[model samples]
Target: MIENPGILFSVLAFLCAIGPLVFIHEMGHYTAGRFFGIKADAFSIGFGREIAGWTDRLGTRWKIGWLPLGGYVKFAGDMNPAGVPDAAWLALPAAERERTFQAKPLWQRAIVVAAGPFVNLALAVLILAGFAYAYGVDRTPPVIDQVAAGTPAAAAGLAPGDRIVAIDGVAMATFSDLAKFALIRPGQAVAVTVQRDDRRQAMPLTIGTVRQRDRFGNEYRIGRLGIAGGKPVYAPVSLIEAPLAGVRATAEIVSGTVETLGQIISGRRSIDELGGPIRIAKVSGEQMSLGWPAFVWLLALLSINLGFINLLPVPLLDGGHLLFYAVEAVRRRPLEPQAQEWAFRGGLAAVLLLMLVVTFNDLGAVGVWQRLAGLIG
Candidate 1:
């Protein structure tokens, strides 16, 4: 029933985009397992039916699956369903059990599980560095690019030709600086300085409240300044500088993600804005049509996200398992079987709930909900 080329392209893009990243992520586990003297039974990319596969001398089956959503690495003597406890594994004798993930030292297991996310983070940094190196950084100068007619800026006598010299007598070096003055402190009246034909003029301006939409259909409040500023051009720098640029961008992205999460928790952000697989497909398809640069940028951003999500302290996640292992290490014993089972059930429920929420948000954003409502109307 998939007729649209855009949908098809989106599917392909999702596979192409997520497959390598997932493969690399799982590979991190596989390689770390090997390093920790654990034996991997199977390494698969994607899920469900195996489309193609080959086995290595070590008896590890490398495979491509029909469902390209995600992937996994199965280590020998591990519990079924990954990281579970197995009676057979326990019965397999100490030497064999040592190959199990739980049987290894806590530090070793943590490294193996943590490697996937770590690789993703590293890839993000590298991609960011590469991007900064290719394109010189851009910043908006304090000069107004355009002013909306009848808006606050225009009403306050701000003009397109005006160059912002300062705000409240604080010398403004760039247009972005002036913008931040408006954005972070919305609804506050502030003094503005401008250069009019070599003469400095001052005026009072107030920030306006605006609605911003996320990947999901929900909206959030942001400060709006009705003027545009031109980005100051910076020449591309040396390789060294490129990595520094990468660090700056990546740090900002991480910080933004954290801040957004905090806002959502505090009710300042809407949960309806959460995106799911459908949204990702749409984005992937759109990016593919846009060009490779945009696609690559999305990939890097998603990679960083994937890395961050995996590190959350939730059961069934890498971080969660690492946390349990840390506790086990500290206690010198594993947690009770019932406790582990309960933790897993809770984790599974949380994940399913998240999935449902995101699916609903995606459907709404894609106009499915709106179309149905229109039909009813």
Candidate 2:
């Protein structure tokens, strides 16, 4: 088991990071429902027994629960979470029927339900922009901070503080460019020009073999250098540039996700890389240990993930509900209860199965289950 302060910090970071994201998501539903004249019975963050709660004049219960996993906003007529089906409430009096969710116009219902995921997406974009504004955009500069002990640069006698003047005969400008070059050639040799000790020199170095794993069981490959570069400073941009930064960051993340998914589908990437909450928790802990900045960045990444996952077309999720709303919009009526129920059941199964697989993968990656088995043996 991981017992470092890093792990504990990560656990806290995970909660702190997700707590507000969930709240914002629920708030979206609450806001839209209120706008459409639908009363909300309760707005609660987390699940299980309530830790703190207060009732509003509107007779709504707003509470904070002990669990930090997620939250929900219950509508006045929701009855059960999925909302009472139309036929079941037909026998109720007219006044009572008015409060029921099924009685609302399909468009209104769709807006209320879809609001949660939409809020998440909006939060991601805003956060990205905020990060960019605060940190300024990181541009690639052709500088080598330090080369790995057994990396190609190390073998070629490259030392720390060597600024790469050029790569592959092309003028180098940023660390990003150097990073891209390194990533592209995992085991290939390349010519590099560096300024070391007020002198310029050219060297041919073969990228080192992949070391793959470290003492902590973490895996990373070296570029055959004994030293790497220090942090190179970049000029911060004005607030006006923040939104553009956010858009670019969001686009990059979305593009990367799409590419990764494609790679997985095409067998270029392994399914073993899929991780669940366990992996996230571990990573969160490690990042938190690194410092506040790392922790905050992790929070932003997780927020984006939460938003992305909630948009998947799985019944019981925000996306699944939206899908049903689309169907109703076209058909001019809700789908049959039997069909909806079945779809929900399938979705539930799929989600649970995915969680299980991801959990297993996470534990395996962390060597937790293996250690446990070894102890038993």
Task: Candidate 1: count the clashes.
Answer: 5
lDDT of 2: 0.74
How far is 249's C-alpha from truth in model 2 (Å)?
0.5
- Write one digit per residue (lDDT tens) for candidate 2, span 329-356: 7897778877888888898899889888
lDDT of 2 at 204: 90
TM-score of model 2 vs. true structure: 0.74
Tell how far residue 145 is off in model 1, in angstroms: 7.4
Query: Candidate 1, residues 199-314: lDDT per residue as tens digits?
Result: 98788888677877744233556666689876566667689898887877787688668867876787756788678888888777777766788889999988988888888988
State the C-alpha lDDT per candidate.
0.80, 0.74
Best of the candidates, lDDT:
1
> What shift in Å separates residue 68 of candidate 1 from its native position after superposition?
2.3
Using TM-score as the measure, the top candidate is 1
